[model samples]
Target: MNIIRNPKDVLSGLLFIALALLFGWQTADLPMGTAVRMGPGYFPLVLSGLLGLLGIIVVFNGLRTPGEMPTGIAWRALIIITFSVVFFGFAVRPLGFLPALGVAVFVSTLGSRLFRLQTALIITAVMVVFAWAVFIKGLGLPLPLLGPWLGGY
Candidate 1:
């Protein structure tokens, strides 16, 4: 008589619950006004509550169902993707938006099992162009194409 079933669902539910708690705590200081006059924390608090509720539901479902544990984790993809995102955040100021984004996208693509250099390059190029169009041109943001490290003021 196994008490725990569907390990994947339980883990996912726990993750969501943890995120909900984090966000909720972070927004606790902000003012939450009335419905008619919403404040900064209102939406975030609502979303957090919803996330917690969803997590509870998922956990219950997992407990009710009978399923096997997840086979294995994709450590390479996980590490690469996480590293690329952190790198982009840190490099954005020094390397600028375009270069940082390009490098991050290319490196992230390498995390895929079927990754190819050419494919990664193409994806990086497309993402750079799209970001430039949408964020720089369309939104009229002040982000430079190249930063101090690349000597683009």
Candidate 2:
């Protein structure tokens, strides 16, 4: 008999699939233009579809794998994450995207059991590059890359 040992992956996969379906259903009415000129809902729909695909893959992987049960929720980590998101929102305008993201990541890791400033800074730096590439370059978002404090944007 096939054992689905990784219950977490299975549950998360199902949840992601549900989310994708919801997103698709909600945006069904929106025009989905060609790849060259996408409609408002085009990106969301694509993202949802990709998420659904990943969910399916995760479910399959979970089915064949053995994994431990989930432990109790980390309340401190959760609170830190929530607050870091709030920090990011406030810091974005003043500090700009990269700086705000760095600060947010640095602050968020503080609540973790394995809090490491060096690791947080390293991760934040990597994410900054990724965020810059995805948001500013790939998505052509108009977020300020550098804030006024750094120099004239």
Candidate 3:
């Protein structure tokens, strides 16, 4: 039996395979120790292998079936999310963790159909506090609590 032959699926599969190979190649240089004590490269190597396998499966499935394919890319949401991430990266250094996170959340929430201003605010607050508490305070990741106001945390 023929599997789905959709342009979107084929493109996605190819992209996944390329990314997996890139990741695998990047991780290959890292040291891989014995099974008892895994090295830094171990997890990435395994993950890349799995990704490659999934990509192959997707490609094969696509080749075997032919059908109408819905447009895979949601450009609006994708653009919004991408910009939000970019904004987060830029704002995190200058605006501090809390404000950067709030803006990120707000920008990201704009992608959703059900987003409300109040809910976005609440979610941003919750996410910022949670991230601060968990990553900065609890895990002790040295993230900047304050921005340029205090000259870099």
Best by lDDT: 1
lDDT of 3 by residue, 2-119 (tens): 4556756676788889999999999988998866677879878988989988998878777876756765667878899899999989988888877788888888999887879999
Selected candidate, larger lDDT, 1 vs 2: 1
Model 3 TM: 0.57
Error of 3 at 35 (Å): 14
Best by TM-score: 2
Please report how far candidate 1 places residue 101 from its true position, in Å. Answer: 0.6
Worst lDDT window (10 residues) for model 2? 144-153
13-118, model 1: which lDDT tens digit per residue? 8889999999999999999997767788987999999999999888888888988797899999999999999999999999999999999999999899999898
Model 3, residue pairs in steric clash: 2-64, 2-65, 3-64, 3-65, 4-65, 5-65
**lDDT values for all models:** 0.92, 0.87, 0.82
Q: RMSD of model 3, in Å?
A: 5.0
Stretches of candidate 2 off by over 4 Å are 1-3, 147-153
